[model samples]
Target: MILVTGATGSIGRPLVRRLRRDGTAVRALVRDEAKGRALGCEFVVGDFDDPASIVAALAGVDRLLLNGAGALPADGEQPMVRQQKTIIDAALDAGVERVVKVSVWHAAEGGRLAEGAHWEIERHLKASGLSWSILQPNGFMQNFITGQGSFTADGNLVGAYGDGAVSYIDCADIAACAATLLTGPPRDGETFLLSGPQALTHTQIAEKLSAALGRTVHYVSLTADDMAAALISQGLAPRFADDVAVLTQGLASGIAAPTTTAVRDLTGRAPRTFDEFLAAHHEALAALAWAPSR
Candidate 1:
Protein backbone atom coordinates (compact mmCIF):
# COMPACT_ATOMS: atom_id res chain seq x y z
CA MET A 1 0.00 0.00 0.00
CA ILE A 2 1.08 3.56 -0.68
CA LEU A 3 0.38 6.47 1.64
CA VAL A 4 0.13 10.00 0.27
CA THR A 5 0.46 13.00 2.53
CA GLY A 6 -0.95 16.39 1.53
CA ALA A 7 -3.54 14.47 -0.44
CA THR A 8 -5.86 17.44 -0.77
CA GLY A 9 -3.16 19.67 -2.19
CA SER A 10 -2.49 20.49 -5.85
CA ILE A 11 0.10 17.73 -6.37
CA GLY A 12 -1.30 15.08 -4.04
CA ARG A 13 -4.84 15.24 -5.43
CA PRO A 14 -3.66 14.39 -8.91
CA LEU A 15 -1.27 11.77 -7.61
CA VAL A 16 -4.06 9.99 -5.74
CA ARG A 17 -6.27 10.05 -8.80
CA ARG A 18 -3.55 8.75 -11.07
CA LEU A 19 -2.62 5.97 -8.69
CA ARG A 20 -6.23 4.87 -8.28
CA ARG A 21 -6.80 5.02 -12.02
CA ASP A 22 -3.79 2.75 -12.43
CA GLY A 23 -5.24 0.34 -9.84
CA THR A 24 -2.56 0.89 -7.23
CA ALA A 25 -3.47 0.43 -3.57
CA VAL A 26 -3.26 3.98 -2.22
CA ARG A 27 -4.29 5.68 1.00
CA ALA A 28 -4.28 9.36 1.78
CA LEU A 29 -3.16 10.78 5.13
CA VAL A 30 -5.62 13.54 5.88
CA ARG A 31 -6.13 15.71 8.93
CA ASP A 32 -9.85 14.94 9.08
CA GLU A 33 -12.36 12.37 7.97
CA ALA A 34 -14.17 14.87 5.82
CA LYS A 35 -11.06 15.53 3.75
CA GLY A 36 -10.33 11.81 3.56
CA ARG A 37 -13.82 11.10 2.30
CA ALA A 38 -13.54 13.95 -0.17
CA LEU A 39 -10.48 12.27 -1.68
CA GLY A 40 -12.53 9.20 -2.65
CA CYS A 41 -9.76 6.79 -1.69
CA GLU A 42 -8.56 4.75 1.23
CA PHE A 43 -7.38 7.24 3.85
CA VAL A 44 -6.39 7.75 7.46
CA VAL A 45 -6.84 10.79 9.65
CA GLY A 46 -3.36 11.99 10.55
CA ASP A 47 -1.36 15.14 11.09
CA PHE A 48 2.39 15.62 10.83
CA ASP A 49 2.30 17.31 14.23
CA ASP A 50 0.90 14.12 15.78
CA PRO A 51 3.49 11.36 15.81
CA ALA A 52 1.04 8.65 16.89
CA SER A 53 -1.35 9.55 14.12
CA ILE A 54 1.43 9.34 11.53
CA VAL A 55 2.63 6.01 12.88
CA ALA A 56 -0.88 4.63 12.67
CA ALA A 57 -1.33 5.92 9.16
CA LEU A 58 1.84 4.14 8.03
CA ALA A 59 0.44 0.73 8.93
CA GLY A 60 0.74 -1.72 6.01
CA VAL A 61 2.03 1.02 3.74
CA ASP A 62 5.16 0.23 1.78
CA ARG A 63 5.77 3.36 -0.32
CA LEU A 64 5.07 6.97 0.71
CA LEU A 65 4.76 10.41 -0.77
CA LEU A 66 6.21 12.97 1.61
CA ASN A 67 4.54 16.28 0.82
CA GLY A 68 2.88 19.03 2.83
CA ALA A 69 2.40 22.77 3.29
CA GLY A 70 5.28 25.18 2.71
CA ALA A 71 7.02 27.73 4.89
CA LEU A 72 4.86 29.88 7.15
CA PRO A 73 5.22 33.42 8.54
CA ALA A 74 6.22 32.19 11.98
CA ASP A 75 9.42 33.23 13.73
CA GLY A 76 12.51 31.01 13.84
CA GLU A 77 12.64 27.67 12.02
CA GLN A 78 9.91 26.84 9.52
CA PRO A 79 7.33 24.40 10.91
CA MET A 80 7.72 22.09 7.90
CA VAL A 81 11.31 21.40 8.89
CA ARG A 82 10.08 19.82 12.11
CA GLN A 83 6.88 18.37 10.66
CA GLN A 84 8.54 16.60 7.71
CA LYS A 85 11.41 15.40 9.86
CA THR A 86 8.89 13.81 12.18
CA ILE A 87 7.26 12.11 9.24
CA ILE A 88 10.63 10.90 8.02
CA ASP A 89 11.41 9.37 11.38
CA ALA A 90 8.00 7.72 11.51
CA ALA A 91 8.35 6.43 7.97
CA LEU A 92 11.66 4.88 8.94
CA ASP A 93 10.21 3.21 12.02
CA ALA A 94 7.16 2.07 10.09
CA GLY A 95 9.41 0.17 7.64
CA VAL A 96 8.29 2.02 4.59
CA GLU A 97 10.51 0.94 1.70
CA ARG A 98 10.50 4.09 -0.42
CA VAL A 99 9.58 7.79 -0.22
CA VAL A 100 9.14 10.52 -2.80
CA LYS A 101 9.52 13.98 -1.30
CA VAL A 102 8.61 17.29 -2.88
CA SER A 103 11.31 19.86 -2.35
CA VAL A 104 11.99 23.31 -3.84
CA TRP A 105 14.67 24.44 -6.27
CA HIS A 106 17.89 25.84 -4.78
CA ALA A 107 17.44 24.02 -1.50
CA ALA A 108 20.64 24.69 0.43
CA GLU A 109 21.96 25.53 3.87
CA GLY A 110 21.21 29.09 5.04
CA GLY A 111 18.89 29.74 2.10
CA ARG A 112 15.79 31.76 2.85
CA LEU A 113 12.23 30.48 3.22
CA ALA A 114 11.33 27.08 1.75
CA GLU A 115 14.84 26.56 0.44
CA GLY A 116 16.40 26.34 3.89
CA ALA A 117 13.50 24.38 5.33
CA HIS A 118 13.58 21.80 2.54
CA TRP A 119 17.34 21.53 2.82
CA GLU A 120 17.04 20.55 6.46
CA ILE A 121 14.34 17.99 5.70
CA GLU A 122 16.38 16.62 2.79
CA ARG A 123 19.30 16.07 5.10
CA HIS A 124 17.14 14.27 7.63
CA LEU A 125 15.45 12.13 5.01
CA LYS A 126 18.80 11.21 3.46
CA ALA A 127 20.18 10.02 6.78
CA SER A 128 17.03 8.17 7.90
CA GLY A 129 18.10 4.90 6.18
CA LEU A 130 14.94 4.91 4.04
CA SER A 131 15.04 4.61 0.25
CA TRP A 132 14.14 8.06 -1.07
CA SER A 133 13.92 10.24 -4.17
CA ILE A 134 13.54 14.01 -4.06
CA LEU A 135 11.80 16.23 -6.57
CA GLN A 136 13.22 19.76 -6.55
CA PRO A 137 10.81 21.71 -8.69
CA ASN A 138 10.67 25.34 -9.73
CA GLY A 139 7.70 27.62 -9.05
CA PHE A 140 4.27 26.14 -9.47
CA MET A 141 2.11 27.29 -12.35
CA GLN A 142 -0.89 27.03 -10.02
CA ASN A 143 0.46 30.06 -8.17
CA PHE A 144 -1.20 32.22 -10.81
CA ILE A 145 -4.62 30.69 -10.24
CA THR A 146 -4.22 30.76 -6.46
CA GLY A 147 -2.77 34.29 -6.50
CA GLN A 148 -0.12 33.28 -4.04
CA GLY A 149 2.46 36.05 -3.76
CA SER A 150 1.79 36.76 -7.41
CA PHE A 151 -1.10 39.20 -7.28
CA THR A 152 -1.75 42.61 -5.76
CA ALA A 153 -4.95 44.06 -4.31
CA ASP A 154 -6.05 45.18 -7.78
CA GLY A 155 -5.55 41.64 -9.20
CA ASN A 156 -2.44 42.69 -11.06
CA LEU A 157 0.55 40.37 -11.17
CA VAL A 158 3.06 41.84 -8.72
CA GLY A 159 6.65 40.75 -8.11
CA ALA A 160 10.30 41.70 -7.77
CA TYR A 161 11.16 39.69 -10.90
CA GLY A 162 12.06 42.38 -13.39
CA ASP A 163 12.63 40.93 -16.87
CA GLY A 164 14.01 37.58 -15.74
CA ALA A 165 11.89 34.52 -16.42
CA VAL A 166 10.85 31.60 -14.22
CA SER A 167 10.21 28.11 -15.44
CA TYR A 168 7.06 27.30 -13.52
CA ILE A 169 6.20 23.61 -13.69
CA ASP A 170 2.61 22.48 -13.59
CA CYS A 171 1.60 20.65 -10.43
CA ALA A 172 -0.02 17.93 -12.54
CA ASP A 173 3.34 17.20 -14.15
CA ILE A 174 4.94 16.98 -10.75
CA ALA A 175 2.22 14.54 -9.70
CA ALA A 176 2.85 12.44 -12.78
CA CYS A 177 6.51 12.16 -11.84
CA ALA A 178 5.55 11.11 -8.33
CA ALA A 179 3.18 8.50 -9.66
CA THR A 180 5.93 7.06 -11.80
CA LEU A 181 8.37 6.93 -8.92
CA LEU A 182 5.86 5.38 -6.56
CA THR A 183 4.60 2.72 -8.97
CA GLY A 184 7.52 2.06 -11.28
CA PRO A 185 11.04 0.76 -10.68
CA PRO A 186 12.71 2.67 -7.90
CA ARG A 187 15.13 5.49 -8.70
CA ASP A 188 16.25 5.60 -5.10
CA GLY A 189 18.56 8.35 -3.84
CA GLU A 190 18.07 10.37 -7.02
CA THR A 191 17.13 14.06 -6.97
CA PHE A 192 15.16 15.32 -9.98
CA LEU A 193 15.13 19.02 -10.83
CA LEU A 194 11.77 19.65 -12.51
CA SER A 195 10.69 22.62 -14.60
CA GLY A 196 8.27 23.56 -17.32
CA PRO A 197 9.20 23.48 -21.00
CA GLN A 198 9.91 27.21 -21.16
CA ALA A 199 10.75 30.12 -18.92
CA LEU A 200 8.40 33.11 -18.74
CA THR A 201 8.69 36.54 -17.22
CA HIS A 202 5.92 37.87 -14.99
CA THR A 203 5.18 40.45 -17.66
CA GLN A 204 4.71 37.68 -20.20
CA ILE A 205 2.63 35.78 -17.68
CA ALA A 206 0.38 38.81 -17.22
CA GLU A 207 -0.15 39.03 -20.95
CA LYS A 208 -1.12 35.36 -21.01
CA LEU A 209 -3.49 35.95 -18.12
CA SER A 210 -4.97 38.88 -20.02
CA ALA A 211 -5.63 36.67 -23.01
CA ALA A 212 -7.05 33.84 -20.93
CA LEU A 213 -9.10 35.88 -18.44
CA GLY A 214 -10.36 38.29 -21.10
CA ARG A 215 -9.18 41.17 -18.94
CA THR A 216 -6.20 43.51 -19.07
CA VAL A 217 -4.12 41.94 -16.34
CA HIS A 218 -1.10 44.09 -15.63
CA TYR A 219 2.36 43.34 -14.22
CA VAL A 220 3.41 45.65 -11.41
CA SER A 221 7.14 45.50 -10.88
CA LEU A 222 8.55 46.56 -7.51
CA THR A 223 11.91 46.66 -5.82
CA ALA A 224 12.63 44.22 -3.02
CA ASP A 225 11.95 46.81 -0.31
CA ASP A 226 8.68 47.91 -1.89
CA MET A 227 7.48 44.35 -2.17
CA ALA A 228 8.54 43.64 1.39
CA ALA A 229 6.64 46.68 2.68
CA ALA A 230 3.52 45.69 0.80
CA LEU A 231 3.66 42.17 2.24
CA ILE A 232 4.16 43.58 5.75
CA SER A 233 1.02 45.72 5.29
CA GLN A 234 -0.87 42.48 4.66
CA GLY A 235 -0.09 41.46 8.28
CA LEU A 236 2.79 39.12 7.53
CA ALA A 237 5.60 39.11 10.06
CA PRO A 238 8.19 41.73 9.16
CA ARG A 239 11.05 39.25 9.09
CA PHE A 240 9.17 36.66 7.04
CA ALA A 241 7.93 39.22 4.54
CA ASP A 242 11.39 40.70 4.15
CA ASP A 243 12.84 37.26 3.56
CA VAL A 244 10.24 36.59 0.88
CA ALA A 245 11.12 39.87 -0.83
CA VAL A 246 14.79 39.06 -0.73
CA LEU A 247 14.13 35.71 -2.36
CA THR A 248 12.02 37.39 -5.05
CA GLN A 249 14.83 39.81 -5.77
CA GLY A 250 17.14 36.86 -6.41
CA LEU A 251 14.78 35.71 -9.16
CA ALA A 252 15.55 38.97 -10.97
CA SER A 253 19.02 37.60 -11.65
CA GLY A 254 17.70 34.74 -13.86
CA ILE A 255 18.69 32.17 -11.27
CA ALA A 256 15.46 30.22 -11.95
CA ALA A 257 15.33 30.82 -15.69
CA PRO A 258 16.69 27.56 -17.04
CA THR A 259 14.31 24.80 -18.11
CA THR A 260 15.02 21.15 -17.47
CA THR A 261 14.00 17.82 -19.00
CA ALA A 262 13.53 16.07 -15.67
CA VAL A 263 9.76 16.03 -15.91
CA ARG A 264 9.78 14.54 -19.36
CA ASP A 265 12.54 12.11 -18.49
CA LEU A 266 10.58 10.78 -15.53
CA THR A 267 7.06 10.90 -16.96
CA GLY A 268 7.97 10.04 -20.59
CA ARG A 269 6.42 13.24 -21.88
CA ALA A 270 7.27 16.87 -22.13
CA PRO A 271 6.11 19.10 -19.31
CA ARG A 272 3.21 21.39 -20.07
CA THR A 273 3.94 24.87 -21.36
CA PHE A 274 2.49 27.96 -19.73
CA ASP A 275 -0.17 28.23 -22.42
CA GLU A 276 -1.22 24.65 -21.86
CA PHE A 277 -1.36 25.20 -18.10
CA LEU A 278 -3.57 28.24 -18.55
CA ALA A 279 -5.85 26.26 -20.85
CA ALA A 280 -6.10 23.28 -18.52
CA HIS A 281 -7.04 25.61 -15.64
CA HIS A 282 -9.44 27.79 -17.57
CA GLU A 283 -12.30 27.70 -15.09
CA ALA A 284 -10.03 28.44 -12.15
CA LEU A 285 -8.54 31.39 -14.00
CA ALA A 286 -12.03 32.65 -14.75
CA ALA A 287 -12.94 32.49 -11.08
CA LEU A 288 -9.69 34.17 -10.14
CA ALA A 289 -10.36 36.95 -12.60
CA TRP A 290 -13.67 37.74 -10.94
CA ALA A 291 -12.68 37.15 -7.33
CA PRO A 292 -11.77 40.00 -4.98
CA SER A 293 -8.02 40.52 -4.94
CA ARG A 294 -6.11 40.88 -1.71
Candidate 2:
Protein backbone atom coordinates (compact mmCIF):
# COMPACT_ATOMS: atom_id res chain seq x y z
CA MET A 1 0.00 0.00 0.00
CA ILE A 2 1.13 3.56 -0.64
CA LEU A 3 0.83 5.87 2.38
CA VAL A 4 0.45 9.61 1.81
CA THR A 5 1.39 12.25 4.34
CA GLY A 6 0.06 15.79 4.26
CA ALA A 7 -2.95 14.37 2.48
CA THR A 8 -5.05 17.48 3.00
CA GLY A 9 -2.53 19.96 1.64
CA SER A 10 -2.64 21.60 -1.78
CA ILE A 11 -0.52 18.87 -3.37
CA GLY A 12 -1.69 15.97 -1.26
CA ARG A 13 -5.43 16.48 -1.78
CA PRO A 14 -5.21 16.14 -5.54
CA LEU A 15 -2.63 13.39 -5.31
CA VAL A 16 -4.98 11.20 -3.31
CA ARG A 17 -7.75 11.74 -5.86
CA ARG A 18 -5.51 11.02 -8.83
CA LEU A 19 -4.12 7.90 -7.25
CA ARG A 20 -7.61 6.68 -6.46
CA ARG A 21 -8.69 7.31 -10.04
CA ASP A 22 -5.74 5.21 -11.15
CA GLY A 23 -6.92 2.33 -8.89
CA THR A 24 -3.94 2.57 -6.60
CA ALA A 25 -4.13 1.37 -2.99
CA VAL A 26 -3.60 4.62 -1.04
CA ARG A 27 -3.86 5.52 2.62
CA ALA A 28 -3.67 9.10 3.82
CA LEU A 29 -2.00 9.84 7.16
CA VAL A 30 -3.92 12.68 8.72
CA ARG A 31 -3.89 14.24 12.13
CA ASP A 32 -7.61 14.94 12.05
CA GLU A 33 -10.19 12.22 11.52
CA ALA A 34 -12.64 14.66 10.02
CA LYS A 35 -10.10 15.96 7.49
CA GLY A 36 -9.11 12.44 6.50
CA ARG A 37 -12.74 11.41 6.01
CA ALA A 38 -13.24 14.59 4.02
CA LEU A 39 -10.49 13.40 1.64
CA GLY A 40 -12.91 10.68 0.45
CA CYS A 41 -10.30 7.90 0.75
CA GLU A 42 -8.80 5.41 3.13
CA PHE A 43 -6.89 7.16 5.89
CA VAL A 44 -5.01 6.51 9.14
CA VAL A 45 -4.94 8.99 12.02
CA GLY A 46 -1.34 10.07 12.60
CA ASP A 47 0.98 12.98 13.20
CA PHE A 48 4.71 13.24 12.55
CA ASP A 49 5.26 14.59 16.01
CA ASP A 50 3.79 11.40 17.41
CA PRO A 51 6.14 8.54 16.60
CA ALA A 52 3.73 5.87 17.79
CA SER A 53 1.00 7.25 15.59
CA ILE A 54 3.36 7.19 12.60
CA VAL A 55 4.26 3.60 13.39
CA ALA A 56 0.56 2.79 13.42
CA ALA A 57 0.05 4.60 10.12
CA LEU A 58 2.89 2.77 8.37
CA ALA A 59 1.43 -0.64 9.10
CA GLY A 60 1.33 -2.88 6.03
CA VAL A 61 2.60 0.01 3.92
CA ASP A 62 5.31 -0.63 1.37
CA ARG A 63 5.57 2.80 -0.26
CA LEU A 64 5.36 6.11 1.62
CA LEU A 65 4.72 9.63 0.44
CA LEU A 66 6.74 11.67 2.91
CA ASN A 67 5.45 15.23 3.12
CA GLY A 68 4.11 17.32 5.95
CA ALA A 69 4.37 20.80 7.45
CA GLY A 70 6.86 23.43 6.33
CA ALA A 71 9.18 25.88 7.99
CA LEU A 72 8.05 28.50 10.48
CA PRO A 73 9.49 31.63 12.10
CA ALA A 74 12.18 30.24 14.36
CA ASP A 75 15.74 31.28 15.12
CA GLY A 76 18.53 29.18 13.57
CA GLU A 77 16.30 26.13 13.92
CA GLN A 78 14.04 24.17 11.61
CA PRO A 79 11.21 22.08 13.05
CA MET A 80 10.66 20.42 9.67
CA VAL A 81 14.03 18.74 10.01
CA ARG A 82 13.00 17.07 13.24
CA GLN A 83 9.50 16.21 12.04
CA GLN A 84 10.39 14.63 8.66
CA LYS A 85 13.46 12.95 10.02
CA THR A 86 11.21 11.28 12.53
CA ILE A 87 9.02 10.06 9.71
CA ILE A 88 12.03 8.74 7.84
CA ASP A 89 13.19 6.84 10.87
CA ALA A 90 9.75 5.38 11.36
CA ALA A 91 9.51 4.46 7.70
CA LEU A 92 12.79 2.61 8.06
CA ASP A 93 11.55 0.67 11.06
CA ALA A 94 8.13 0.00 9.54
CA GLY A 95 9.63 -1.93 6.61
CA VAL A 96 8.45 0.60 4.05
CA GLU A 97 10.13 -0.07 0.72
CA ARG A 98 10.12 3.34 -0.94
CA VAL A 99 9.61 7.01 -0.16
CA VAL A 100 8.61 9.97 -2.32
CA LYS A 101 9.25 13.32 -0.67
CA VAL A 102 8.29 16.90 -1.53
CA SER A 103 11.19 19.26 -1.18
CA VAL A 104 11.87 22.90 -2.07
CA TRP A 105 13.78 24.25 -5.06
CA HIS A 106 17.42 25.14 -4.33
CA ALA A 107 17.48 22.61 -1.50
CA ALA A 108 21.11 22.64 -0.43
CA GLU A 109 23.14 22.65 2.71
CA GLY A 110 23.59 26.13 4.26
CA GLY A 111 20.69 27.59 2.28
CA ARG A 112 18.15 29.54 4.23
CA LEU A 113 14.72 28.40 5.49
CA ALA A 114 13.00 25.55 3.61
CA GLU A 115 15.97 25.15 1.30
CA GLY A 116 18.30 24.18 4.12
CA ALA A 117 15.69 22.16 6.02
CA HIS A 118 14.70 20.07 2.98
CA TRP A 119 18.34 19.37 2.17
CA GLU A 120 18.94 17.79 5.56
CA ILE A 121 15.80 15.64 5.27
CA GLU A 122 16.77 14.56 1.75
CA ARG A 123 20.11 13.39 3.06
CA HIS A 124 18.44 11.34 5.74
CA LEU A 125 16.07 9.73 3.25
CA LYS A 126 19.02 8.77 1.06
CA ALA A 127 20.88 7.20 3.96
CA SER A 128 17.82 5.21 5.05
CA GLY A 129 18.48 2.65 2.30
CA LEU A 130 15.01 2.92 0.78
CA SER A 131 14.02 3.59 -2.81
CA TRP A 132 13.34 7.32 -2.97
CA SER A 133 12.44 10.04 -5.48
CA ILE A 134 12.69 13.71 -4.56
CA LEU A 135 10.68 16.42 -6.26
CA GLN A 136 12.20 19.90 -5.90
CA PRO A 137 9.41 22.16 -7.00
CA ASN A 138 9.57 25.85 -7.76
CA GLY A 139 7.20 28.45 -6.35
CA PHE A 140 3.57 27.38 -6.00
CA MET A 141 1.06 29.58 -7.82
CA GLN A 142 -1.33 28.97 -4.89
CA ASN A 143 0.92 31.04 -2.67
CA PHE A 144 -0.89 34.16 -3.74
CA ILE A 145 -4.16 32.81 -2.38
CA THR A 146 -2.64 31.16 0.70
CA GLY A 147 -0.86 34.39 1.63
CA GLN A 148 2.26 32.37 2.27
CA GLY A 149 4.55 34.47 0.11
CA SER A 150 4.20 38.21 -0.53
CA PHE A 151 1.03 40.12 0.32
CA THR A 152 -0.01 43.36 1.97
CA ALA A 153 -2.64 43.78 4.68
CA ASP A 154 -4.96 45.17 2.00
CA GLY A 155 -4.19 42.12 -0.23
CA ASN A 156 -2.02 43.92 -2.78
CA LEU A 157 0.78 41.71 -4.10
CA VAL A 158 4.08 42.70 -2.48
CA GLY A 159 7.60 41.43 -3.04
CA ALA A 160 11.26 42.31 -3.61
CA TYR A 161 11.53 40.55 -6.96
CA GLY A 162 12.48 43.71 -8.89
CA ASP A 163 10.97 42.40 -12.15
CA GLY A 164 12.87 39.12 -11.97
CA ALA A 165 10.57 36.30 -12.95
CA VAL A 166 9.68 33.03 -11.18
CA SER A 167 8.45 29.95 -12.98
CA TYR A 168 5.68 29.39 -10.47
CA ILE A 169 4.24 25.89 -10.69
CA ASP A 170 0.81 24.45 -9.91
CA CYS A 171 0.59 22.21 -6.85
CA ALA A 172 -1.66 19.81 -8.77
CA ASP A 173 1.15 19.31 -11.25
CA ILE A 174 3.51 18.58 -8.41
CA ALA A 175 1.03 16.01 -7.09
CA ALA A 176 0.81 14.39 -10.52
CA CYS A 177 4.59 14.08 -10.63
CA ALA A 178 4.60 12.43 -7.22
CA ALA A 179 1.86 10.02 -8.25
CA THR A 180 3.81 9.07 -11.38
CA LEU A 181 6.98 8.46 -9.40
CA LEU A 182 5.22 6.32 -6.79
CA THR A 183 3.22 4.18 -9.22
CA GLY A 184 5.73 3.83 -12.05
CA PRO A 185 9.08 2.10 -12.05
CA PRO A 186 11.33 2.89 -9.16
CA ARG A 187 13.46 6.03 -9.60
CA ASP A 188 15.48 5.50 -6.45
CA GLY A 189 17.62 8.47 -5.47
CA GLU A 190 16.47 10.52 -8.48
CA THR A 191 15.69 14.18 -7.88
CA PHE A 192 13.51 16.14 -10.31
CA LEU A 193 13.47 19.96 -10.53
CA LEU A 194 9.81 20.70 -11.27
CA SER A 195 8.73 24.01 -12.79
CA GLY A 196 6.00 25.54 -14.90
CA PRO A 197 6.18 26.33 -18.64
CA GLN A 198 7.33 29.95 -18.23
CA ALA A 199 8.44 32.63 -15.79
CA LEU A 200 6.50 35.80 -14.99
CA THR A 201 7.25 38.86 -12.95
CA HIS A 202 5.02 39.85 -10.05
CA THR A 203 3.73 42.71 -12.20
CA GLN A 204 2.57 40.23 -14.83
CA ILE A 205 1.03 38.12 -12.09
CA ALA A 206 -0.90 41.08 -10.71
CA GLU A 207 -2.07 41.91 -14.23
CA LYS A 208 -3.32 38.35 -14.59
CA LEU A 209 -5.12 38.61 -11.27
CA SER A 210 -6.65 41.92 -12.37
CA ALA A 211 -7.87 40.34 -15.55
CA ALA A 212 -9.44 37.49 -13.61
CA LEU A 213 -11.05 39.69 -10.98
CA GLY A 214 -12.13 42.49 -13.32
CA ARG A 215 -10.45 45.01 -11.06
CA THR A 216 -7.09 46.77 -11.02
CA VAL A 217 -4.60 44.84 -8.90
CA HIS A 218 -1.20 46.18 -7.93
CA TYR A 219 2.27 44.81 -7.22
CA VAL A 220 4.29 46.75 -4.70
CA SER A 221 8.04 46.27 -4.97
CA LEU A 222 10.32 46.77 -1.99
CA THR A 223 14.02 46.39 -1.37
CA ALA A 224 15.11 43.43 0.77
CA ASP A 225 16.11 45.68 3.66
CA ASP A 226 12.87 47.56 3.35
CA MET A 227 10.88 44.34 3.57
CA ALA A 228 12.86 43.33 6.65
CA ALA A 229 12.23 46.68 8.28
CA ALA A 230 8.57 46.41 7.55
CA LEU A 231 8.40 42.98 9.15
CA ILE A 232 10.31 44.18 12.20
CA SER A 233 8.01 47.16 12.53
CA GLN A 234 5.07 44.76 12.43
CA GLY A 235 6.44 42.94 15.55
CA LEU A 236 7.64 39.77 13.79
CA ALA A 237 10.69 38.07 15.27
CA PRO A 238 13.74 40.01 14.04
CA ARG A 239 15.94 37.02 13.19
CA PHE A 240 13.22 35.28 11.23
CA ALA A 241 12.34 38.50 9.47
CA ASP A 242 15.97 38.99 8.41
CA ASP A 243 16.22 35.47 7.06
CA VAL A 244 13.15 35.90 4.91
CA ALA A 245 14.45 39.31 3.87
CA VAL A 246 17.71 37.76 2.66
CA LEU A 247 15.79 35.22 0.60
CA THR A 248 13.71 38.06 -0.85
CA GLN A 249 16.93 39.89 -1.74
CA GLY A 250 18.27 36.86 -3.58
CA LEU A 251 15.10 36.64 -5.71
CA ALA A 252 15.99 39.91 -7.44
CA SER A 253 18.67 37.93 -9.28
CA GLY A 254 16.17 35.43 -10.74
CA ILE A 255 16.16 32.37 -8.47
CA ALA A 256 13.50 30.30 -10.27
CA ALA A 257 13.73 32.20 -13.55
CA PRO A 258 14.05 29.14 -15.82
CA THR A 259 11.42 26.52 -16.54
CA THR A 260 12.16 22.81 -16.58
CA THR A 261 10.72 19.73 -18.32
CA ALA A 262 10.61 17.53 -15.26
CA VAL A 263 6.86 17.81 -15.07
CA ARG A 264 6.33 16.85 -18.68
CA ASP A 265 8.96 14.15 -18.57
CA LEU A 266 7.39 12.60 -15.47
CA THR A 267 3.67 13.07 -16.20
CA GLY A 268 3.76 12.92 -20.02
CA ARG A 269 2.08 16.31 -20.34
CA ALA A 270 2.96 19.97 -20.22
CA PRO A 271 2.62 21.72 -16.88
CA ARG A 272 -0.38 23.97 -16.44
CA THR A 273 0.00 27.66 -17.20
CA PHE A 274 -0.58 30.58 -14.82
CA ASP A 275 -3.86 31.53 -16.49
CA GLU A 276 -5.09 28.02 -16.00
CA PHE A 277 -4.09 28.17 -12.33
CA LEU A 278 -6.06 31.37 -11.84
CA ALA A 279 -9.05 29.87 -13.58
CA ALA A 280 -8.91 26.68 -11.53
CA HIS A 281 -8.69 28.65 -8.29
CA HIS A 282 -10.76 31.72 -9.08
CA GLU A 283 -12.96 31.39 -5.99
CA ALA A 284 -10.08 31.32 -3.52
CA LEU A 285 -8.33 34.29 -5.10
CA ALA A 286 -11.58 36.22 -5.28
CA ALA A 287 -11.89 35.96 -1.50
CA LEU A 288 -8.67 37.87 -0.88
CA ALA A 289 -8.79 41.16 1.00
CA TRP A 290 -8.73 43.21 -2.21
CA ALA A 291 -12.04 41.70 -3.27
CA PRO A 292 -15.42 42.84 -1.98
CA SER A 293 -15.69 41.50 1.56
CA ARG A 294 -17.95 38.47 1.62
Q: Pairing residues by index, what is the TM-score of model 1?
A: 0.96
Clashes counted in candidate 2 amount to 0
**Candidate 2 residue 253 C-alpha distance from true site, Å:** 0.5
For each candidate, what is the lDDT?
0.90, 0.86
Candidate 2 C-alpha lDDT tens digits along 84-144: 9999998889999889999999999978868888999999999888889999999888777
Best by TM-score: 1
Superposed by TM-score, candidate 2 places the C-alpha of residue 128 at a distance from the truth, in angstroms, of 1.1
For model 2, the stretches where C-alpha displacement exceeds 4 angstroms are 73-77, 229-238, 289-294
> Which residue pairs show backbone clashes in model 1?
none
Candidate 1 lDDT by residue in tens digits, 28-102: 999889989988999999788889999999999999999998747455446898899999998888999999999
What's model 2's lDDT at 138? 92
